[model samples]
Target: MNLLINVFLLSVFFPYITVIKSLDTQPTALFLGTVLFLIYFKAEKKQNRYIFYILILSILSIFLFEKSNIMMSIRGILNYWSLGIISYVSYELFKRNKIKNSIIKRSINAWFILGFIQTFYSKYFFKFLIVGMRTSDDRGVTSFATEPTFYGIICIFFGILVIENFKKNDCILFFSNLLIQILFFSKSSMVVLFLLIWISLYILKNISLKAILFSSTSLVSFHFIIINFLKDTRVYKLYIKSSDLKKLFFEDHSLNMRLSHIFYSLKGALQNFLLPNGLTQWIEYVRIETLQKTYFHTLTPTTSARIMSGFGGIIYESGLIGIIFIGIIFFCLKKGLKNKEIAIFIIIISFSAIQPSFPLNGFILGMSIFNLEKRRIHKNEKIKSNDCCRN
Candidate 1:
């Protein structure tokens, strides 16, 4: 059951599946919801306190912003509550005997293989397979997110798995993932690629000249393939626009718009810092108005903005207090990264900044933190309980 849920969640971001467009969250949600219900009814003890707190926060946020439409309120509530449920369920699974290291290895392998296939299609076969599909502005395949950055994030996740496996001497798996990352030509994935390699070497305390040389070579080789060889390809054109790249990173206008959105949200946050507008009103007032002016007709109101913009959205809907609450959660998780679970937690938090999918990222973050803490506690107990006998 846990494996199924993980696969479903992983597939939610896969780029080649058309069905994902209409029902991206449904499969995972159904599986998760079922598990949640089963746990609630059958467990000898209730779920943890954090789960209860998350539920309360969701419910309270809804009531506090009662003016929101039913759909908005429901989405808002689910967005928060889903995180708690996912975290709790993942922790439960990790605690069980079924989730051994081998299981995790298999799961990671499956995700990498799937990702590789998707990247191949996006790079070469997407047009033949799905006609009339258009790539989004950020060069993502039309079947999933409009932006390539979304897929890039997924590729990065798989890439991390690859790096970890490679460090453990799983050469074939690492190279396979490396090939897929190159095929995708996603800038975000490239960034993550380097970051993961650096982290892996650093964590293992084995940073050597060979590792640095390999990293640099891989990056250069990827650039040559994408830029020099794939330049004339249709998907390449759609998914790798030079203009979007320039604007996303170097342009002043883009930065200004994000800054303006953040400032406005912060202003609203301060005014209604305790209890703010309902979800619908918040969306209309902040997202719609802000995008209409700054993004013009090119951008959708519901699309995620920069980090500060998301922070602003929270403030607009739930006020400064709510933002602070969420901020506290993030801060705690960051501190907890000193534990071994840092890899997963960092992955989740990083995605949260880049994607507006909410509870998916939040849930992953929470689970990673919980699992890491559990590992740390267990290790400490073992050391303390066995110190005198260890001679």
Candidate 2:
């Protein structure tokens, strides 16, 4: 049973099979929802049971208030609940020592193997994995993911898992992730954001003038290397596009779309008194907000036009409730992590970058659980040491 659960947990993000065009549905939701729904009947912990309760409340909220688009709201419920289950299962696996070290090693190996296969046969694999979604014609290696940027995001998950599990013998996995980000994905923003947080934490741990100077120098050198050598990469292109404000706003459809999410989501939330508009209504809100704009015709009404920013989606969907949800999430993360600042930094960086999607959300929470359990054990050991010394 544990092995089966582990397999499902690991494969949650495995090249999602889209079911609905507008909603961007993944089949894993159905599998997860069915399995976890049954398991909830036998759950012992209130923490586990509360998930279903929340799901029920969310469904009720949709029925009660979501008159504009109830079906979309239901889709949202299933998607989020399944994601919540992924997190729950991940927390359970790590907490109970069900996720073996060997499993982690094998999963990382499988990631590389799939990446290799996809690299050589990009067109074939892309069509097989993704359907009815927007994609870049000149995208670099996407592995088993739908797109290059998403592949980078997926790599972030594996990177976190590798760092958490193999502290000593992680050089291969470390560089492999880096290669995937830079050479394969041709996008380094994810890596840069992660490294910045990591370096910031390291400096905070060992605060000194020399440490600050060294980090600053290293960052500058890294930037210089990227600008000079990696001109073809997506981040570099985006950077180049940032020079002209007018061009950046109008010409860069990608940037413009992302900006619209931020601008309109905030505007809509302000007008709605910080209350949730409705589930899956974010794209509609974006549509309504941008319809008057000159560039409205250029934007699609499909899921591709949905909010790319996770934090923005949260605010746009739930408003003040979203803010409270974030607070609770990070508060728990802070309690679990040794360095609460990492949690804070992750939240800040993820504001504009991370997309709010299935399995990704759950995978992150599961990773947080890993750190949380690690911290708890270390804290217990310290308390025990203090008690023994006093005695």
Candidate 3:
């Protein structure tokens, strides 16, 4: 039963699974979690009063402020409530020892392996392994992910995990991740790489001038190598567009949308007293005339849209409530890993870049708590060994 729950939780991360793809990822995760929760039926209770409080406040906010749009308000409530439930259930499972980090580690390793396989057989037989495999993009390999950005984020996260663990297969998995990131060549990949290095250095006991020089030299060398050898990839395209800000803004749809989301969502949050306009109501905050001034006025009320970021969604939808909301969720997640700060840094980084996925968020929180417990157990063992040595 515990193993079943572990697999179900891990399934949330691998969105490309055919069964999940056919059934839809988020709802399936929620449904399976619900069933497992009912079957296992642990009467053990944990205190998550803060989450419930935020939910109550958010529901009340919708009624008080968003009564004008009854249907959209309901949608907002449902979205928020569903994700809250997922986070709570995940927290409970990990807290109760139903989830395991070892399984997560294996899954991450498998993802990297599949990434290599997909690089060669993407057009031939990749679909046999992953659903919705794209055949057109020759720029890079995305493994089972839907896009380069998602793949990049996954590599950074699991890459960190593998590095920390130092298993016999660590070198192979680490290099495989690095190779895939280079091939993917997306902005998110490069940005995450830079941030990871910076954070790793910052976490060290001392920041010497020599270390800084070496880091700069390595980064410059890497940039030059990419420009000279991987010129056919998207990084070179970004380099060429860097010369003309106008072309960069107008030509790159991905950058344009990202910038637009950040700018408009931030503007909306400030304009609306920092309260979210309601879930999926980001369109309401996006003014057509204002958007037309920037030439991104292509949005419509009926268009399916989100703020395309975690903080963006939180701030745009809940405003000031978002602070309390994220705080509570973060608290539930625990410190996570030895370098808890970096783990959180990566979470925020990914959340801000990717569209909000509740299942993924829940998994992250659950996994963090699991890591905390693992760390405690290891600490206890070390203490016991020390006592034996003293005796």
Against the hidden reference, what TM-scores do the models get? Answer: 0.64, 0.78, 0.73
lDDT of 1 at 370: 57
Candidate 2 has its poorest 10 consecutive residues by lDDT at 49-58
**Clash statistics: count for each candidate:** 1, 0, 5
Residue 205 displacement in candidate 2 (angstroms): 7.3
* Cα-based lDDT for every prediction: 0.48, 0.59, 0.58
Residue 83, candidate 1: C-alpha displacement in angstroms: 1.4
Off by over 4 Å in 2: 13-25, 33-37, 45-67, 117-126, 129-137, 186-233, 243-246, 280-284, 291-305, 338-341, 353-356, 370-391
Error of 2 at 9 (Å): 2.1
lDDT of 3 by residue, 140-165 (tens): 56565655556666666555555544
After TM-score superposition, what is the CA distance of residue 33 in candidate 2 from its true location, in Å? Answer: 5.9
Error of 3 at 352 (Å): 3.3
Badly placed stretches (over 4 Å) of model 3 are 18-25, 38-42, 48-83, 96-102, 128-132, 163-206, 209-214, 243-247, 287-292, 295-304, 330-334, 347-353, 369-391
Specify the highest-TM-score model's number: 2
The root-mean-square deviation over C-alpha atoms between each candidate and the true structure, in angstroms, is 6.3, 4.3, 5.3
Candidate 3 to truth, TM:
0.73
